[model samples]
Target: MTTFTALTTLDGKAPAEALGAAMEGLDPAPTGVGVFEMEDGSGLWEVGGYFDAAPDEVALALLAAAHGARPFAVSQLPEVDWVAHVKRELAPVEAGRFFVHGSHDADKLPEGRVGLLIEAAMAFGTGHHGTTLGCLRAFDRLLGAGIAPRNVADIGCGTAVLAMAAARCLPDAQIIASDIDPVAIEVAEANLAANAMAGAVTCVTAAGFEADPLARRAPFDLVFANILKGPLIDLAPAVADHTAPGGHVILSGLLTHQAEEVGAAYARCGFNPVASDEIVDWTTLVLTKSG
Candidate 1:
């Protein structure tokens, strides 16, 4: 079946989210709505909605005007199996000792490296992104340096790939992974099972460390947060508070320009910078908590 989409962009996250929320009451009513900040350093956020029928342009215009967003661009999308398309485009990714791939590329997995099977679905973090790869490499570097955390948490884990990698390295470690969206948690669970870590890593539906499971496992020896700059900055203190003294942290999902500010944020929270790896347009930072 053909689907319609209405999309617009504006400054600030509040307006974008407001526009997304407003789209829910439209005459055609969207089947899904999303608001995301663009990573092109434009400080702009995009709000989009999917619909089963044609949307009223007048309603869209009014909503855009109210939210101070750009004029809505509506278009019909041809029916395409996006999952199959994603599978076709995704090849295996190797970062340090970690290997991420779909079942079709199982033969490509290196014999001695840690293998994580991540199906090509709507979820994110297949280890192909510079941010995810940088994070994995950071972990491997730390491991190589004889630093292994017994308790680890992957905040905003898209597919739980990082958590699974840690689990593979430290069989006895207490590992937890979480995301704000339940759908992401579902994807994480499936990926965990594919990696033979079904119940090894606890998957929680949460934003940051709000879930009871995370709070109980406080003072983690390591934490992985591969989220965007805004949340990374906001999470600095909380991440520092939950991390044990002398613990390590791997942070990514940031543009190279934003790395300094994010690093400063964590530095203020007693997380001293250890090392940073820049890959393409993104940079990942590894830090250690000051005792």
Candidate 2:
């Protein structure tokens, strides 16, 4: 297994400066930064980047830079062998009436459960992340309520997990799943097919609701966006415009503290908060459009 080291430094350098310096020795550098408040309420930032060096060397450099402040750490990530990892991680499982697994589990699905096998490369939404699980729980709640949505859209669909969940729940429903990343769209297609849901869900690559051709169909009974706060705030209008009268929207992936800002954005877009829940430090919201 190839190992890559991640070095986190804190010498009072600005985030950009620290990131720039960290990038010097790293190859195929970090894609983004993840910032969250520590348990003690102190802000913590994790700069994720890739490196081909020894983990100890990376750790020593980052730790030495801190000079005993203990604000730096290094961790190693196994270089992902996409095919092998995907196969193992997506192994089959039976959860009540729902059979859940990844594409690699195609031949192992247990009988007597509705099987949903997906193959999500690295595009998110394999039901592993907390946010994705939260959204799935929320979707399950809606399903339990016996609400049959005529149309559904999974915005920023990622690996199209939510969209697939919806399709599983509302088999007769019209559903569209979209993402800004073309790679994500490709993954979603594979995932849908692996689950034998290719015909039930349409996957597309789009910037947001505004840029999506399906948005013109308008007024979907259910819409979901599990993305970052910035994009969520910016896409409020498009979310509102595409949701049908008396429809509902589920938003996740925002910090609990950012809920107010996100709520206000949706309010401006004509959505009223129906419910809000928090898990860990993340917030999930359910909003409804007035009839």
Candidate 3:
């Protein structure tokens, strides 16, 4: 069945969330509503709703106006098997010793390499995005240099792909992967099971490093944070506090232009950039805390 989407953006979270809540009371009620920040540090939040039937445009416009948001844009969307589309566009990705592929390409996993099974169902952190690829490569390069981390964390670990890679490389390491969205935590758990890593990495639902369990396991030898620039900048101090002396961090999910600013924030927290990877529009940085 086809669907319709009504979307609007506002300057702050309050109006965006209010608008999202308003969508639920529409005549042709939305199937779901979502509010998310733009992640660019623009302070803009987007409100969107999906509906099986076309939403009442007048109601949408009234809601937008009431929330001081831009006029809502509604459009019909064709039904799509997003997983199939993802599989078609994302071929197997090789980053250093890590081979990330969908089950359809299972036979392509080469010998003597860490294979990460990331089905199209979970698109984020599938090692296909430039950010994820850059992070994986950075991690592999670190391992290749004979540096081993005993304790690690994958913040905002969408599918826990990074954490799993570390698990594969350093079998005895303690790994914790977390995300604020419970759905992402669920996906991470499922991906871990699919890769026969059901309990290899501890999965948690928390915002950034806020989980008490993560705090208890502080001073991690390495941390993988592939979230966008805004949150990365915001979490710099906390990340630095949790990183062991001389510990390493692989940071990404920033555009090429945003890396410098994000790196500068972490630098203020006593981190020094050790390696940088640039792929197309994304940039990933590896940094070390001073011992």
User: Runs in model 2 with CA error above 4 Å?
Assistant: 1-48, 51-99, 103-113, 120-123
- TM-score of each predicted structure versus truth: 0.96, 0.71, 0.96
Q: Could you tell me the lDDT of residue 285 within candidate 2?
A: 90
Model 3 over residues 53-72: C-alpha lDDT tens digits?
98999989989889999999
Which lDDT value does model 1 have at 80?
97
Which 10 consecutive positions of candidate 1 have the poorest summed lDDT? 115-124
Quote the RMSD, in angstroms, for model 1.
Answer: 1.3
Candidate 2 or 1, higher TM-score? 1
Mind giving the per-residue lDDT tens digits that candidate 1 earns over 6-83? 999999988788889989999989999999999877899999999999999999999999999999999999999988
Write the residue-wise lDDT of candidate 2 on 1-291 in tens digits. 555645453333355355545455443444433332232223443444444554445544553454423333556775667767666655453433455666556667666555666554543566655567667766666766777897999999988878887888787888998898898888888877776777788887888874545756577989989997777888998887788888999899878888898999999888998788777887789888877
Candidate 3 TM-score, C-alpha based = 0.96
Number of the candidate with higher lDDT, 1 or 2: 1
Return the clash pairs for model 1, or none.
none
lDDT of each: 0.92, 0.70, 0.92
lDDT of 2 at 100: 60
Tell me how candidate 3 scores on lDDT: 0.92
Candidate 3: segments with Cα more than 4 A from true spot: 39-43
